[model samples]
Target: MEGFLQLLLNGTALGSIYALIALGYTMVYGILRLINFAHGDIVMVGAYAGLFTALAVNGPAHPDLFHFFIVLLAAMAVSALLGLFIERFAYRPLRNFPRLNLLITAVGVSLLLENLGQVVFGATPRVFPDIMPSMNWFQFGQVAITNQQVTVFGTSLFLMVVLEWIVLKTKLGRAMRAVSYSHEIASLVGIPTDKIISFTFAVGSALAAAAGILVCISYPKVDPLMGVMIGLKAFVAAVLGGIGSIRGAVVGGFLMGIAESMVVGYGSSTYRDALAFAILILILLFKPAGLFGKYQPEKV
Candidate 1:
């Protein structure tokens, strides 16, 4: 029972991170129907930003709440700008081009970011600074919960709720939904479709940045190439939960995290990734629209 509880706690924390990243994926897809492959690298940028913040502040020591929040906000702000830049410069000019062109551009941008990150940040992995103090808050039998875990879970949930509120209750959210449903109609109705799309990218990137920072807190490692695998997993989670569905992304992320954790607990760690892919395939075959996704038919 204790083992089960421990796994559950760990899985929830992992799921929270995945969900954060997946929200970015889903948000971008929802708005533009384009998969920004570079999205993950934006998270990488955020990790580095956080790393820089830590190094500049005190190096290696745990940060107090004020400094930690500053670092988190800095990462998010930088990442958001990066995202806006990608959308404005790379994607906006090619808005009328074929989607294949956009897809290729996304891949190219991803590669460019990776190389740039390597050049600027170095390829060697850096130790993520201890921002939050690691103090155990409580224990259930053999399962010990710490301050870091609470912080990760709490912050993730707060952001998710805020995102949900923005998407559901705000006027901007209505415009976003309108654009997602039909950009032409949305534009006709006076919605600034282009601006809305840019906002989507910025918001998504901020979420990814937040995820990167939180993951660093949990695992305490940062590298230029770190976002690749996790990004793929988050993409898979978005698909699994139903792409374009915010709620679905969150659910899928949690499910993916729990499944991965279970596989690691019971099976070989080497197969953990294989298991995730296998599950994706199975989900695709059985329900391509995902558990919560609805299939839409397009006019020829």
Candidate 2:
């Protein structure tokens, strides 16, 4: 029972990180209906930002929260701006083209970003600084958890809350909804569809950046390929939650995280990934729209 509880808490923490990254995937999908395969690579770039942050401040420079926040902001800002640029340069021209063209472009962008990261950040693994102290908040029975886990879970939840509020309340959120539901109608109603799309990418990228930072804290390693599994897992989370549903993203993220953790806990950790996909396959076959997604009639 104690072991089960430990697994649960650990899974919840993992799920929170997945949820954060999955939110980015779902948000972009909701607005543009574009997969943005490069989205994961953006997370990788953010990790590089954080690694540099750790080196600069916590390394020889002496540690400070101000410096930490600056690095975090820089990472997020760079990612958001890059997302905006990708939408403009790579996707805008193909907006009127077939969805396949856009899909191929997304794959291209993903590859480009991955390779660019490899070239710039190098293939070497980098270590992140110890931001959280090793104090346990409280012990439940025989289980133990550190401040880092609490920080990761807490920060991810806070971001999720802020995003959910923005989407459900703000005027810009309404405009985004309008554009997403039907671009032609949104534009007819005087909404700037192009701008809305750009904003969506920026918001999604920022979320991905935060996820990157949090994952770094959890795993304490950063490399060019770091975002691959997280990105794939996040994409699965988005699919499980109904690709366009924001609430679904959060639900799917936490669920997938727990599921994956349980697999690792009970079985060979090497098969952990396969277990995740096996579950995803079951979900796809049984409920194609996912837990939070709705089944829409195909339009001819």
- Best-fitting candidate, measured by TM-score? 1
lDDT measured at residue 26 in model 1 versus the true structure, 0 to 100? 91
What is candidate 1's local distance difference test score? 0.90
What candidate 2 gets wrong by more than 4 Å, as runs, is 59-68
Look at candidate 1 and give me any clashing residue pairs.
none
lDDT digits (tens) for residues 1-300 of candidate 2: 888888889999989988888888888777777888988989988878767766766632644446556667777888898889999999999999998999999999988888887898788887777655557887877897867688778888988988878888999989988988999999999999999999989988888998888888788888898888889898898888878898999989989898888888887799877866886798899998888888998999
**lDDT, each prediction:** 0.90, 0.84
What is the C-alpha lDDT profile of model 1 across 214-258, one tens digit per residue? 989999999999998888888889999999999999999999988
Q: For model 2, what is the C-alpha lDDT against the true structure?
A: 0.84
* TM-score of candidate 2 against the unseen true structure: 0.95
